[model samples]
Target: MSKRRLMNTAVATAALAFLGACTSMAPKYERPAAPVAAAFPDAAASGVPSAPATDIDWQAYFADARLKQLIDIALKNNRDLRVAVLNIEAARATYQIRRADLFPTVNVGMNLQRQNYDVKELYTVGASVSGYELDLWGRVRSLSDVALANYLGTEEARKSVQMSLISQVAQLYYTMLGDEAALKVTRETLTTREDSFKLTKLKFDNGAASELDFRQSESLLENARASHALQTRLRAQDENALALLLGQGVPSDLPGGLELTGQGLVAELPAGVPSEVLARRPDVRQAEQQLIAANANIGAARAAFFPRITLTANGGTASTELSGLFKSGTGVWSFTPSITLPIFDAGRNQANLDVAKVNREIAVAQYEKAIQTAFREVADALAGRANLDEQARATAAATASEEARFKLADLRYRNGASSYLDVLDAQRSLYTAQLALVQVQTAQVQNRVALYKALGGGWTEPKAQ
Candidate 1:
């Protein structure tokens, strides 16, 4: 058989041996414990009954067209996502490097040496060929398996990055929408106060209202106008932030303004039991893969304790006369098989083994930590979702009540049934309520995004492009 065929057969045999050993020693992976409420019993006691988390597709979940567009733009343009793609490619190259360890390394070299000698002496010229070192103890095979796991881990990590990026984009979009809604309320408040001021002034001129009424109306109008200006500024800032997320200039114009009036409800979130749940979290899975790689390294390190066998072979021709160099009579070949045993290396192999085991232990702890953290995050996000959903509803009701109170107060003041102080109080309360509603709405959307991320949403690779 050819040397290449022999090498392949040897590698196969070694791999089978290693795999058999690995199967016997490898521990079954289990996720560490985390504190999550088994039942969110009070969740429905406060707000509109929320369904249990659902594993809905992101495309269908974020119903707003503009928001979806922004998310898509961010997925394409986010610098972080781009960096993650590069990391995946780097991991792929690293995997290739490790996979190559099991195979023989072959190289071609040429030598040209010329030396002058005494007249009675003759110069000797020689040339030959060399093959490669063969892996006989499965060291390279184990290392290659470790690298493959790490590579797969990196790919999953990239997907996790993508998911997070989408969730952030969605949240920012919702924030902009909420800002625009607030801006609208501010402008409307300003217009309403201005009209009320004009009516108060007319009443004062007709000798029916006092100068105090006109002054109070004027003050309310000024405050509302100031609020409008501040809301406009805030809206501009929010737009600038969204533009940056889209990888555009901060001053880039947004085609669609925030439109929250008809914003649809979020879909349910996904819920998974603890069994192999770490597989869903990219970071946790990455940690586990590192642990696996570290485990494999132990095998590689153990193999270092055994003897290494290397075989070298060369075939060529050498002759004093250049014409005879290619003749059969000048043919030459050498085959060398050598063994290297750790007789006295001052404990280098032992130190390496210790280091590998230590690293493996560290990886194991990290993998467990990652899994615990992921579980905590998912549970916290769900609780936030439940709380924020209730808060939004309460704020909405308060806003409606405050709006009615303001209207009634204005009517009573115009009809001389109450002092202008009541109108001022009503107007202030209405503004506060509206602002609070806006905040809670924003929170609800953002928390939804967070929950989606906890459930591993948003980072799916695009198809066809």
Candidate 2:
């Protein structure tokens, strides 16, 4: 064959080979079975609710306007969330690089040479494709697939981070409200105790009451004062924690928040079947993406054992003088095709394949573990939902009983029908009951937040109006 005809045939052959090398050697991927129960253990037996938790936008889920504002701020400025977003960007860039490798990189070049002091300038100008791999066994494609999966995984990870941030902000905001409520109770108790202490002291001085009664009343007053101080400190700490979650200092102009008892979170969120709900979780999706990447790695490792073909080609004109570089008769072209078959590399290719298989196995295990972990979290949150509301109700009832007992005890003591110790005991009991009620209420609200998060709520934002 003539030189020109031979070059054209070779180029055509390479093009056909490139078009035919699309087979992947990776094992067929099937998602591992979820190693958990079919349904959450604490899910109600009646039926699924009208709406799944995932469908409820966080804006509508949290009734408090202040909480919605805080979540918005956290999504925008939280450092951890910011890092997650940046990671997605990095992963996308890396994927772009890998994808670029699937195509030849063409470049234009010019060279001039002078040998042995004979200033014969060989001027040349050409477009060249250097060492471009013909993906005969899908190695480059497999790597590109891996990068794409990883990029998708990072996007899911960002969603997971945002969900957690929303949950944290809501829980902490409820805690701060509970702390404020407890502080109010403590201050009220302190005031009542101070008045009681003054009355007892006057009676003791007038010989109508013993010094023991006066001392007992004074102890109650001091205990109330201590509780007030402790609650004050706790409320401040809660606010600081909330500020951190908000990614900025708590603003003074925040809209008024609902009382802890009034936080109208969706009370009866549906815990759908585990297979359905867990699949929607961003963490679980992220894990599956990672597993896909690992699977693609196996294809690349298998490809390593096959022959690799690379092509380097240049076509243009060359002349001894710069002005003749592009002349018709000065044309020159070269095509150098190289092939590398793995003869023996001390079992390195086999070892790499082994590593890839093991890594894929590890990914499978992790993916299942992610599903199991999600199952447990949702189960635990559902359990809390089933019990905390009743607990709060019982605690509130006990607090009311304690309040009435304190009133009766004080009345009896004033009528000279009972010892002052009875009144003191009743005061202590009422104060303890009040604090317990606040704690229970706080837990109840936080439990709802946890359930919402476990059900994969809060990752989605409301559409812009």
Candidate 3:
């Protein structure tokens, strides 16, 4: 046979061999069973209205205009979220690189050769494919699968970061409102006590009130002043925290937040079935993708037991004279195929396969743990939802009653019908009750924000502009 005919037959045989190598050694994939309760305990009994949390857009879920504005700014600017998105972009590029390995790479080259023995010069020009691996054992395909899984996992991670940033912005905004309310209360209390102190001092000077009464009045006035100063510091700190989340200094013209009691967040967030809801959570999805990646690694490790085949080929024209390189009868071609089979490696292939399996097992545990953690967060948020509203309501009623008692006690002491100690105790009780009510109201609002995040409410696929 001529050299050309012989080369054609060899190429055909290699093609046929590659066509026969279709089966993968990778084990079939099956998702592990969920490791938690079927439904959120008391999710329905918590009186939350029944609607898919995911279906509610963030703008509607947090109805305050200022809050919506803050969330918009955060999604656009938060540094952590920006990094998460960039990571997805990087993973996608890596996956593209790995996928290209399934096909042969082509190159064009020119070369000149001289041999001393023959005293001849050869010129050649050709397109070449060098050392392209044939996926005879599915090693390349498995690696591609691993890369794809990682890319998908990174996308899910970006969503997780977005959800956290939205909730953080809302929570910090509510805290600022709560502090503002407390400051208002302290200022009013200070004004009232200051007037009372003046009256007590005047009465003491007139010999109608004892020095003890004057001293008690002075103490209450100072206490309110101190509380006002502390609340001033706290509110400023809350603003600074918000600025960090916004990824810039707080805007001088930023709109004020709704009162803590008036924040219009949805009172009830439906958790649905734990298994179903957990499936939608980005963190849980990310963990499962990681598990899939580990499983794909096992296929690559198992492929090591089989032969690795590589093919190299070049075709062009060669002639002693450069001008004659492309002339008839000057054409040259070469095809080389190589195979590598492991004979002995101190059991390295087996050890690698074992490591892959162990990693798969570890991934399984992490997947389940992700589900468990999501379930716990949702349950905790639901418990807060069920109880905090009632707590705030009861605390508000107590505060009102204490305010009335203080008025009565002051009147009685001014009439000389009661000791000044009763008035002092009444003032302290009213002040404590008012602060407690404000704190409970803050908790109720903040819990709504928590439930929104725990249920994976804030993020959606950004629309193409």
Candidate 4:
């Protein structure tokens, strides 16, 4: 046969082989149905119209200027968030690399040879494709799909990290405010105790009051002083914790915090339908992406049982003299094809397929767990919602009544209408009630923050232009 006819045959053979091997062995993918309630408890049972938390804008949801500023700093500087962003870049790069494998790589090169047995030198210039694997069984495509899924998973993971960071900053910021408010209460109490101690000491000096009365006043003053010192340390510790969350020093320019009563978060956020959790929660979406990657891996494992085809081809001109390398009629070409069939693998392929199946099952479980955890969190937050306001109101009333009782007892003691023991008891009750009131206020505010986060209300997606 003529050289031209042989070249034509080789080209046609390669084309036919390429066209024949294009079928995929991977199973079709269908998202697993969410395995939880169709709607949140009260909203479902009572048919209440609930607003979706996912639709709320985060800045509007928080509504605190200092908190928004802190969240900005955290998104910029938190180490975990930075790592998550980097992971996305890495996963995307890996997917690109795997995708490139589906096509042949062509390279150009030059070579010169000197024979040891002969005194002549030969030169060759060529274009070649080296060991290009043909993805006839969709093996490369399946692997590329896996990498793509993982890349998407990484993106969702970054979003999950962002949401968590914002929630943490809000919680820590509120805690610091509570600590500062508690410290203020202690300082004011200390000042009142100091004035009372001075009066009692003067009465004792004048022999108008007994040593027991004077010592009792001194005891109350000392207790206030100790409490003041303790609260001061606690407030400082809270500030330090805020610094850590900010990933830098707390800004001196930060706006004064809202009183627990003034934190602008709504008392309750509507928990939307439970089925929406699959689409709204970042962790759940990440788990689903992971499941997709595992399912793709099963296709790659199945492809392993078929033959892998590869081709290595080179075309160039050869000459006895370096100057004649590209001369006509000096052309040379070759095509080499190879096929690998796995006859025996000690059950490695079967094991790989099994592992992929098991991983997919595990991912399904994780996905379900994420929904269950989110459901429980929202339910717990809502459980506190219906009662916290009433609790805080009752505690405040108790505090006010105790303050009145203490004032009346102090007046009666000075008038000799009651013993100092009654005054001491009233003072103790008033102090306890005051502290309890502060705690209830803190709880009412913190519970709102918790509900906002549980409902996935703190992270907003940028509007599409």
Candidate 5:
């Protein structure tokens, strides 16, 4: 064959070979299917609220000044949250490394060496060259895809941690409020019981009341005082907890007591749809990103079975004498194109493929479990909100009734128509009812916070896509 025709044929054969090599392994990325629940579990089908968008605007959701401040501080200063942010940065760095592997590496080095020949061989001062390979059965690219997905998953995890921190700080702050309010109630009851005890003792000394009645009043007074002391300790512990969350010393500057004036139940829980919940919840999204990464890995492991093609170049000088090292004859260059094919490794490839498949399945299960857990949490919050609302309402009504009954009993005892025990019983029942009402109010507030957390409201929305 003539030289031009032979060259043309060779070029055509090389192009076909390259194309054939490229076609053997392909992308195998399919998102795993997720199960769909009709609505949140135990939710009444007929009364189910319409789903809202999963993406909520945080600035609009929490309008309270105190709540917003606590969230901001937790985001900025919480140690765990800061660590989570660092984890995201580290993952991003890992992705960059994986991506850089796709291109050949060129390195330049200066070398000086001396060796003396025993007799037959030349003494040498020598240098050689080397570069790395990217044999694209897309191993590097597929691995990069895995790193990319992992980076994204870490970002979602950071969000999940941030949301949890914000909610926990707010929840603890509210708890501190409740403890303060409860302690105040106990102290006031202590004072009231103290005065009653003093008056009963006076009445007994003057013969207007019996010794037994006086002792009973003293007993009640001591019990209330004891409860007040316990409440004081509880309030201190909650304050310390709040301080630790804020990453500071527990300020001794807590309020002397709390007074509940307008503090009460929220008007209603802003209900949204289940679909929105999936989108808004961070743990769910984090799990899904993990699954995506695992799926990408399957492509990577599968690609490993194909032949790896690499092109390398080495250019440097070697000579027995240092002065002659760079001379034309001493400087040598070479190009090597090589392929590494797997013949057999006793099922290692198959085992890797199987492992990748199994991991994908595991990721699918984790994703499903996350969704299920999210659903359960939302359902629990909804039920708790409703039940606490009813409880507060009922408790408030009973408190009023008990207050009225105690007053009637007091009037009858003063007019000498009722026994001293009746007055004692009435006072104890009244105190218990009022205390229960306070407890219910605190519970209602906590329930609102839980519902906010359950609905995934505390998270800062990711910057617009």
Candidate 6:
């Protein structure tokens, strides 16, 4: 055959082989059935219904301006979240490298040499493709797919981190508000007790009140002092925790914040079907991506059982003299195509395939567990929503009743109708009731934040135009 016809035939053969490389051995992926209940257990019991948390933006869900600012700061400055973002960048770069392997790498170069027996120099210039695998069994492509899945999983992980951070900041901020309220109540109680103690001491000195009355008043005064100190310490510790979540000290210029009782968070977020809610959760999506990567790895392992083909080619001009390197008569070209067929490996490929299959099984388990976990969280949050409102109302009523009882007891003691002991007991009861009310209100608001997070509400932000 003529040289031109031979070259044409070679090109056609290469084109056909390249086309054949598109076949993938990976199993077709179907999402596994959700391993939880069809709907949340508490969804039906909590008859109150509202918008799904997924549709509510966090900025709108949390009514407190200060809390929104704190969330913004945590998203930007938290160290754990920063690490998650960096991991995404790193995974993207790794995926880019894997994708680059699909294409040939061409390089241009020059080589110079001199013969021992001759004064003339040999020169060559060429552009060559070296050791480019033809991917006949889709090994490289499968690996690329694995990398892409991993990259996507990393992105989902970042979203999960952001959602958790938002929830944590809001919860901690609410807790701090509770602490402050409790501390204020304690300080007021302490001031009143101190005044009562001084009045009792003056009456005892004038021989108008008995020694027992003075001693009881002194005991109450000391107890109030201790309670005030305890509350002060608790409030300071709460502020420290809030600062840690904020990733810095609490800003002095923060916007006005709602009291724990006044934090009007969206209380009645809808809990959709388990499948729908789990699909939106970032951790669950991350797990599914991991399962996809494992499936792709099985394809790569299976492909290893087949032959690998590689091509190395160079086209250039060579001349004994440097000036003639590009001359038409000096033109030279070479093609080297090779095949590697596994023959004597001691079951290494089979072991790899087995390992890949086992890894895929593990990934399947993990994905299902993620779904189960998401369902449990949403269910727990829904239960909290159904019950916390009543708990808060009951606590508030108890606090009010204690307040009225304390006032009546103090009035009776001043009129000589009841002993100071009755007044002291009522005062203590009122203080305990007040603290309980603050705690229940804090929990009420925190439960709302939890529902928002469990339903995958906080990770999304509007993209800039």
Minimal lDDT window, size 10, model 1: 120-129
The digit string of per-residue lDDT tens for model 3 on 347-402 reads 99999999999999999999999999999999999999889978988998999999
TM-score of 2: 0.94
> Candidate 5's residue-wise lDDT over 1-465, tens digit each?
233443454354346344433532324655544465656653442343433323444444554555555556556677888888999999999999987766555555555554466433332332222334443566666688789989999988998887777667766766777777778778877887787788778889999999899989889988998888888998889878766776765445433332332433243545555765665688888898888888877777888888776656545565656577666566544556677899998999889888888998899899888877787777887787657767888988998998888788878877889877887887788778887887777766666666666777667663476
Q: Count the backbone clashes (under 3 Å) in each candidate.
A: 5, 0, 0, 1, 2, 0
Off by over 4 Å in 5: 1-36, 41-59, 109-131, 250-270, 315-332, 461-465
Global CA lDDT computed for model 5? 0.69
Kindly report which residue stretches of model 1 are placed more than 4 angstroms away from their true locations once superposed.
1-57, 108-137, 199-219, 250-258, 276-278, 317-330, 344-348, 462-465
CA shift of 221, model 2, Å: 1.9
Quote each prediction's TM-score. 0.79, 0.94, 0.92, 0.89, 0.80, 0.93
Q: Candidate 6: which pairs clash?
A: none
Position 429, candidate 2: lDDT: 94
**Residue 315 local lDDT, model 1:** 45
Clashes of 6: 0
Higher-ranked by TM-score: 1 or 5: 5
* Poorest 10 consecutive residues by lDDT, candidate 6: 1-10
Give candidate 4's root-mean-square deviation (CA, Å). 3.4
Off by over 4 Å in 3: 1-21, 45-50, 113-121, 462-465
Candidate 4 wrong stretches, greater than 4 Å: 1-22, 42-51, 117-119, 321-323, 461-465
Candidate 3 to truth, TM:
0.92
What tens-digit string does per-residue lDDT give for candidate 2 at 141-174?
8999999999999999999999999999988888
TM-score order, best first, reads 2, 6, 3, 4, 5, 1
Per-residue error for 421 in candidate 2, Å, reads: 1.6
Better of 2 and 6 by lDDT: 2
Count clashing pairs, candidate 5: 2
